[model samples]
Target: MIAFDAFRDGETARRLAAAIAAEAQPGRSYAFMEFCGGHTHAICRYAIAEMLPANLRMVHGPGCPVCVLPVGRVDAAIAIAERTGVTLCSFGDVLRIPGSHRRSLLSAKAAGADVRVVYSPLDALALAQALPDRQVVFFAVGFETTTPPTAAVLARARHLGIGNFSVFCNHVLTPPAIAAVLGEAADRPVLDGILGPAHVAAVTGADAFAGFARDARMPVVIAGFEPLDLLQAILMLVRQANSGAARVEIQFSRGVTAAGNRAAQALTAEVFEPRAHFAWRGLGQLAESGLRPRPGFAAWNAETRFEIGDPPPEPRTACRCAEILRGLAQPADCPLFGSACTPESPHGACMVSSEGACAAEWSYGRGRRRIWKELR
Candidate 1:
């Protein structure tokens, strides 16, 4: 494992904080959205907003893989899991997410569905190899960071001549979601710049965001996950917003680059193609935002393997998760935030994952305000 302590240094964070304070425009609020759930967690965990000038704001976007997955998809996974002769394998993060009627894979497991949480796609592949008679489906859900692994597993299944192994691909692209946010800004809070996702950039490359930056006229700085990394990225964003210049910058030079991981990109391209449309939790149906198995991998696609029915859209409850995911609302602004939706009982998708904005705010920022008021 790499030693990341140098990037998380206190002096460096303070220095970046001071630089941001100096660069920020007085009396003008700068709203910069970080399009990664990991970034959101780092920001909230480190109280990055409290350290920043009041005029500067960090808007959370729908970058959390678990948080952005639509209820319908989760429902479909549950349906598959409950079927006879089918073994459903998925990442641990996805198992707890509630579907229609508040049903989760965990609950389905309790009711005797062969739902198993896996750490890696290889583990799911192994399960399929072990159970020759059973149809094993891996519930693959994530952004670009996790897609290549799914692709590799798919390729491996094909190479091994595994007929019973298949994947329920829910991998999504990041650029279209960014466009959706910028396009819908007229009715919502406008974003000045973006703090791009760390892992996504490592796979898709920093150059992938260049066109979006040009189109939206928004600065996107891809930063590492550390606190200091976030502070520096914020400083860069503040400087760009003040200058009215928009460009793509890479701050996480250690992991991400202009070209990114080409081999991984090639593997994903070979295995998957963009779906016509896919439903996101908050952003709704985004065109070419999702991926499905290619024609060569048709037999390995669970969508084609099984017959699933579409359920009507459920009524929007008091949960403001959709608004929060779009950066239009904060966790504190939601009526169900603390009262109806604590970390113990998350009422919406945002509260489900540790990286989620609501979970971060609730876990780190909840008692912080009262303490700050006391100190003041």
Candidate 2:
């Protein structure tokens, strides 16, 4: 097994910090978007920004799948569960996210809905096999990194002739979301570079970002979810920006490659296809951004099997989750963040998700807001 202690070593982090400060130009600012919730959490938990040069900034992106999952989808899952002899299963985080009128799966369960939390899609399939009577729907959600496993479980369920297992596929494409974010940069402050997600790059490969980097004229560095990895990637971004290099680079070479796992990609393609349009919480409807069970797998599709309700009414809360996901605002920027949107009482999807930027900052870097104010 690979030793991970080196990646978390404090001395190495300080050395990397020194290198970043030395190389980052003092005359101009370098603002790069880290397009992964894991990286955002790492940055906050380690106080990486406090150790970096004053000229550098790490903008959070909508990388948390749970946070990006639109409220309507959660409403659909609740609707499915409320049906007689039907059970809805999802990852723990997805269950906590409030749907229409802030009604969560946990609340639905308390109100006699058969909504359960499963660690993996396979567990949902197993539950269906064991029950044999109740219809089981796995509310699938996440980026490319998670799609493959869901696909594998579906394939297994099909092979075993399990009739009760189905899935409500909410798997989204990262490239489209990334494109949407970059497109928004025209109106907002232009980002100098992009720190691509490690797990996403592992599935899509570093080459997946090559075209975007060349066309968008921004350096994209695939970073590992470690403070040292982010620090080193930040240094790489600084150098590329200084040299005027717009290209894709991989900082997490151990797990990621120019061409990622071919078997996983093939399996995923076999099980699912793209939806013409999918609504993201903050990003609105993105074309070909969401995934659905393929026609061949319609027998195991919950959306096709059940009658979902109308889309949830437009959220009208004090929450600024949309702004936070769009990189236009931070957690502390919202009035409800600490006062009303704590983890125990999440007023928004961002606070409900463990991978959300708002949750990361609230848990690890709330003091940064004060520091930022003092600096300003």
Candidate 3:
């Protein structure tokens, strides 16, 4: 077993902070994007930025699944939920995301739609077993890390011959999304290095990022979520940035390897195929970034079973969530950061998920920058 407490040791953090403040180049600036919600949460929860040098800064990426889910998908879930005797199940945070009509799963449920919060796809399968009279659709949404479990449950439902269980698959791929982000350099924020997502690496393998580093000429370090792991990864990235070397490195060796969990990847591939294109909230339509159920599994694909149509264009808002997701802006810069939008009453998807930049900033009071600018 791992002594997780060791990762959070205060003395270790202080030493690492001193080393980072010393090693990071003074005149040359380094801007790294952490491409995972777990990393963003850890950085915020531990006040990691306060230890950084003036020239170095961290940018949050569009890693939160809930934050990037397009409004049309949310509207589709609501459409399914509105049908008589149909129960739409999803993660809790997804319930609060406002859709095209400013409607949400929670609001739909309040209006007597059978929207349910399930912890896992297996739970949705079990719910379908229990409620044989109603159709149970798992409103599945996530990255590679969450895709395997949904695939596993689909396999289980097939084996058990569960007739009423289906999945509204909204799983997205990481590499394509990263490529999409880098491709937007002409208009969006550019990154000097990437603090790669460890959980995503654990599922897709560290090898998935090798092409990105070589092609984009960007340094990428696969990092664990712990504070110490993050600090070490930052040091490694700074070294690469200073040396003018761009390559893929692994700092979270404890959980990630070059090849990753092959079994999980194979399982996901067995159930899903690459979608031609999918629309993200900020990134628009990116080719092969999303996944759809294999046609053979149409019996359990909710999109095939239901008659959901394209939702109308979402009404515009003053929310800067689109720019924020592209690393072009911070939550503090948003006009609605605290006044019109909040966790209690979110005006946008970014405020709805705990991993979202807006929510993390609000929850952790990220405005108190003690070391980034003031001390330096």
Candidate 4:
């Protein structure tokens, strides 16, 4: 096992940063997008972007699950919460994300909807068991890392014959989102390499990024959240760019492997299947990128149990969250980032979650002067 403290050592981070700055070409730009919100948080929190060489740019991807979830989905969850005698449980991050007309589940709760913040699906399950008369719905939203646990809860609920408990599944896949970014980069900035999602890689494995590497010809490094890990991953990407080599490498081997956790994969497969198309806040619709309960677990599906109806017209254009999610714009570029949309009163989803790029920048990156300018 890799020493956790070793990844946090200042000297190690300095060494990696020096190596990166030394290897980075003079005029040639190296743009790498870290495709995980946790990594984004770490980079901003530690000022990793400021430490990087000018040639290497760190662009945030739509890795924040709450940030990427379209307003329509949030509206659907709100609809469930608004139902009489029904309880809606969601992760705290989703509570503040605004839906159509700037409504949120938490706001719905304030207006008399029964919404509760939960740490896990198990908590929702316990709520379900405790209040058998109430219809309990768990608003499950995340990448693969959190899907397995949601699956476990669904399986347990089914096994225990808990009729009132169901999940409003919004689980998304990572690789497909990466593909969506690369495949639709005609009008957007082309990425040189990717620092892949570390936690998602734990469940999906290193090889899961092979297809992206092969197709996009970009190096993918599954990196840990530590400052050292981010620095090392950037160094690795810079080296690959310098050498014109593209492949998927696992820098967070302490948590991820080539094959990943087999049992978790099996459990996920048994419980969930991909949706034909799913609406992402920024990317719009992408094929086979979302998950839903399998036929056997249909009884535990909230979408089928309740007709939440179609989402209202897309959220207003004042929020530039869609552009931020697609890497076309930075958080600072957003007009409402600090003025109209502080974390206390978020104008968009990106400010609602700490993992969101806008939130990370506001929390840690605001005071720092702009160190590197993108040459493109």
Candidate 5:
């Protein structure tokens, strides 16, 4: 393992910022999208974007799994929870995602559904074992980083012959969505580079992005959560762009490896198989963008066990979340930004998710700055 202190010094941050500022061209502007919710949280929490030169802009991508889950999927999960003798378990963030008729999993819980928030899949499994008579469904969502833990839970369920436990697998892939974003540049705005996900890279390896970089001719840096690490990754991308080099570089070397965690990868492969296509809230449908439990474990698959249909009626037309998630528009660009959609009562997925760009800007008090404040 690499030493953590190498990244903690403020001097490292200054050097990285200087390198980025020096390499940034005066007339040219670089738009690099960081494609992970955790990265979004790190950037806003540490105010990493403020450290970069004026020309280099960080565009938030559809990284948050909870945010990207379309309203219909959440409705399906909630419907399963509301069924008699069924218990729904999910992360706290997902519980609040609005469904049809403004009914969320949390709302279902309030209405007497057995909805429980769990930190890990194992916790849901333990609950299943404890209550053998009830059908326990774990609302599994995330990318590669959280897939192995779900796989581990599935393996335990099978080993223990736990028939009551099932999983609503909403796990998505990263590379295909990156490809979709690059393809969108033909009609929409073009992205110069990508600040790839650190947590996902730790599971799938930096090598996962090699194909995306080679095919799109876009430089991608697998970066960490720290402010210094993000700055250094930006500098590294600037250098690569200046030198006309398109490759995958791991700036967060302390946590990431070229090969990544082999054990976690193997476990994921063993339990899950890629779906032909899955719907994202903003990015729409992409081939092989999601995962389903393998046929051997179909008994524990909630989609099959619960018999959920395609999806119910979508949310109203007033929400501009689809555009906001694609990097084509901003939250302020939406008609209902602060007027109709505040943190207290969100109208769109962007405001509902904490790591969402609009939510982060609003909660951290960054977006609505007065001209006098800027002058000061």
Candidate 6:
């Protein structure tokens, strides 16, 4: 395991803040987006925003797989669970995301649907094996980091000839989503750099960011989840910007390598294939953004087993989640923020998932009244 303590000191954070403050160009802002919901949570939980220079700002991207899953998909999963012989399985975070008519998996479970929460795909697979007569559909949702494990489970199921096991693949790719953000309209703030997700890098490798760096001319830093790791990454980006250097840099070297985990990547390639297009709640349809089960394992695909179709009707109007995911607006800028959208009753995905930017803001009270009083 990587040593996480090196980046966990007050001195490191202060030094990084000073470096960033010194390099911030006058009248020019450095907008860096961290594409992982884990990073968003760390930023808010540690109040990293307040520690940065006024010219340096962090934008949240579509990092939370559960949050970005369209309402229609949730409804489809609910439908599967409601089937007489089907048992739907997913992470706990996905249970609360509202679908059409404000229905969610949690609510469906209360209505007698067999919706189960599993920490790993293997757990769901085992459950299917234990009950040979019942159909177990694992809701596989996540980025590259979570894909390989799911793939491994699928491979195992195939080897054992587990006929009742299937996967509702909602795995998404990171590169396409990054491209979508960079390709946003000119009116939006042009990002100067990106703090790439550390865990995702561990699976896809740090080298995957090179294409994005070259194409967008934006410095990409694979950052760790800890407070110090993020600060160091910010400082590194500031230095690169001040010196007019843009490239892919890895700050979380302890956990990430250039080649990444080859075994995991190979497993994912064998079990999952990229979809033509996938619907991201706020980013819309992105090419190759989602994954589907390979033909060799078609029998384990939930889409083929059920009549799932396109996404459901969008939530009510006035939800600024789309703008928020694109970095065009902040959570506070939304009309429903804190009023209609709280942790208890979230009007949008960003407020529902723990890694969501809006959820983090509310959880940590960043830029809220309490923090304002403390600063004053």
Q: Where is the poorest 10-residue window by lDDT in model 5?
A: 366-375
- Local distance difference test, candidate 2: 0.87
lDDT of each: 0.88, 0.87, 0.88, 0.88, 0.85, 0.86
Number of the candidate with higher lDDT, 3 or 5: 3
TM-score of each: 0.95, 0.96, 0.96, 0.95, 0.94, 0.95
Q: Which regions of candidate 3 are displaced past 4 Å? A: 309-314, 367-376
TM-score of 3: 0.96
lDDT by residue for model 2 (64-89), tens: 89999888888888888889999899
Q: Give one digit per residue, the lDDT tens place, for model 1 in 1-376.
A: 7778987888888888988988887979899999999999998888888889888888999999899888889999999999999999998869888787778898899999999999999999999989999999999999999999999999999988999999998999999988888885567668889999878999999999998679878988999899988998888888888888899988898899999999999999999999888889888888999999999998899998996544346458888989998999988888877777777777788888988888899899654464456569
Clashing pairs in 4: none
lDDT by residue (1-376, candidate 6, tens digit) is: 6455766788878887887787788778888999899999999988898999888899988788877888889889988989998888888888888777778899999999999898888889989988889999998889998899999999999999899999988999998888888885676557888999999999999999898778778889999999988998988888777777888899999889998999999999999888898999888888888999999988888998885777754665677888888888888888877878887888788888889888888888764665456459
Q: Which should have the higher TM-score, number 2 or number 6? A: 2
List the pairs of residues colliding in candidate 5.
Answer: none
Which stretches of model 5 miss by more than 4 angstroms? 1-11, 312-316, 368-376
Compose the digit string of candidate 3's lDDT tens values, residues 241-352. 9899999999999889999999999999999999888888888888999998899788999989995554455556788888888898988888887778889889888889
Clashing pairs in 6: 72-312
Question: Could you tell me how far off, in angstroms, the CA of residue 28 lies in candidate 3 after the best superposition?
Answer: 1.1
Which is superior by lDDT, 1 or 5? 1
Residues 86-133, candidate 4: write the lDDT tens digits.
999989989999888889998999999999999989999999999999
Q: Each candidate: RMSD to true structure?
A: 2.3, 2.2, 2.8, 2.8, 2.4, 2.3
Task: Locate the minimum summed-lDDT window of 10 residues in model 3.
Answer: 366-375
TM-score quality measure for candidate 6 = 0.95
The runs of at least 3 residues in candidate 4 whose Cα sits more than 4 Å from the true structure, single-residue gaps closed, are 309-313, 367-376
